[model samples]
Target: MQTLSRWENTPTFFPQFRAALLEHVGSSATVVVIGASDGRLVLPLAAAGHRVIAIERDPVALQGGLVQLPDGTEAHAAGLVERLQQEQLDDRVDIVESDFLDADLPLAARYDAVWTSCSWHYSANHHRPLADFVTRMQDLVRIDGLFGAEFMMPVTARHYLSEHYTSPERLGPYFTDGWNIQLTLRTGQFTELPHIGQPHPHVHRMGALLATRTSSVTTERA
Candidate 1:
């Protein structure tokens, strides 16, 4: 896997990924990130002036990363809160230490965008049906708001958890009815380093989606 700096240097993913979303959700918008591990996906958005609420289930996992500082020294960046503090970005970020499925988020379309990278596909582990999980994510965003996600698929379908692996073809079916699909990119035959300490690397199939909510759903006004 590329280092954080390398990811940012590319025009393909990472830095560009956030920039692409920024076209729809402005830099100052309020964004909700599900499975926001450490500060990788949400930190740059916060730095760019967005109000970010980062949700993660395992607080311990969030604490295990190295953070490079502006002063030329690197530190053992602890949890999300600590990362925000170390970078002096706590004011724009709200750290939510809870299972996203268990948390009671706002009902009235509170966020401008809802995003997840390689996280939403794990809904199956929690026994939340994929369709239902997609619906719940849609419900989190207001009309015209955006919903974005990147899912990692196993090379052999049966090798991993059933709900964890999703095909590029399977994604659109879940959101087409309720969303104005903005972008769908599916690519494969690449090796991905395991994020959760799998000793050996594995071949991967990756798919990403960016969609805008077009359907109406009732929610109490905040």
Candidate 2:
């Protein structure tokens, strides 16, 4: 096992995201991960013998670069690309270092599973409506493929007004047909320890949804 750096040591915002993958995603499957920062989930999925297409926007997060730690010290740390290379998992991943929403992804691309963690909730993506994000992710899934997302639910008064900070129940209307919602979970507000960019303690509520598209375009239109 490779030793993890401070930033690299950070656990995923959604703990069950991996569990869902292990239980639902098959071995040798090809998975697409949105916001795959620094191989947090990418490395493990690759290590499990799955091919991963990681889309990350930050160049520093995609490639090793200087970073300021939570303790207010600057240090050079390895990124997803470097970690994958060091772990000999480079061949298993195709790293796309561009904004997930704007990246010129191949139209033919489809996967066994597509996952995003606290992605759309970011202010950076607020320029686009939340539905746009879900639609894009949905379009990328093949029939019977899994669509998983762990997001920040409304924790503050201001969050309720922003559609981006929503829950699975609120997103239900998007599932017109041929979609099976396997599980939907939410965590009540909890305080989290600070790390890297988030240098102070904060409270957060999270939500997760695991659904599968049951029919393809041809089948849906039939």
Candidate 3:
């Protein structure tokens, strides 16, 4: 983990990741981004001309990111909706403030793609009972819909503290049956977080997974 300031100084890694994500976003695609700290993913999704529903539990971080955006960006902050709403967006792009674990999946509506990055590691209880979180994520996508995620792997401890390390082998059980393992790679980089003065060290092996649902399901089923 680099200092916050050093990390901020460099161009974000999302741009490249976003390029990969766009391939899965069709013309009528709807998207949901969870744990969207500081709207890093939201800003790009909005800029890419896609409608996105960005969910973040931290109000302070959300507000901090929102304040920096130019006016007229199509984004909203709320909890998941009980029913999907009709809106001008290709699919509704919403920003919800709530815990991803407890969020009402039925309210958020189904999406063409559900993408999360670097945030899943923070799931409660080390993402215990993996089935629950996996099901929640899979539910967000329509049948044959794309699921894209960037998860931290076992080697993360080399760059930062021992607490940040996670192994993909431990994370694999959460995926529903028939999910495709599209990409898995071990890569390392020095992240500079200058906000804390000294650059904190971090090493991470990222696993990028792509999967699709076996059946078409409604929000409630999701």
User: How do the candidates rank by TM-score, highest first?
Assistant: 2, 1, 3
User: Against the true structure, what is every candidate's RMSD?
Assistant: 6.2, 3.0, 8.8
Task: List TM-score per model, in order.
Answer: 0.79, 0.90, 0.64
Estimate the lDDT of model 2.
0.80
What TM value does model 3 have?
Answer: 0.64
lDDT of 3: 0.54
Clashes of 2: 0
Candidate 3: clashing residue pairs, number: 21
Q: With candidate 2 superimposed using the best TM-score fit, by how many Å does residue 114's alpha carbon deviate from the native?
A: 0.3
lDDT (10s digit) by residue, model 3, range 1-222: 111211244323455446545655554466788776655455546546667777778765554322222233433332122112211222445767788877666735678778777665563536454345556787777766677666665543342343334444544554436454444444464453333223343433565656555565332321
What shift in Å separates residue 143 of candidate 3 from its native position after superposition?
Answer: 1.0
- Each candidate structure's count of clashing pairs: 0, 0, 21
User: lDDT of all predictions, in order shown?
Assistant: 0.67, 0.80, 0.54
User: Worst lDDT window (10 residues) for model 1?
Assistant: 1-10
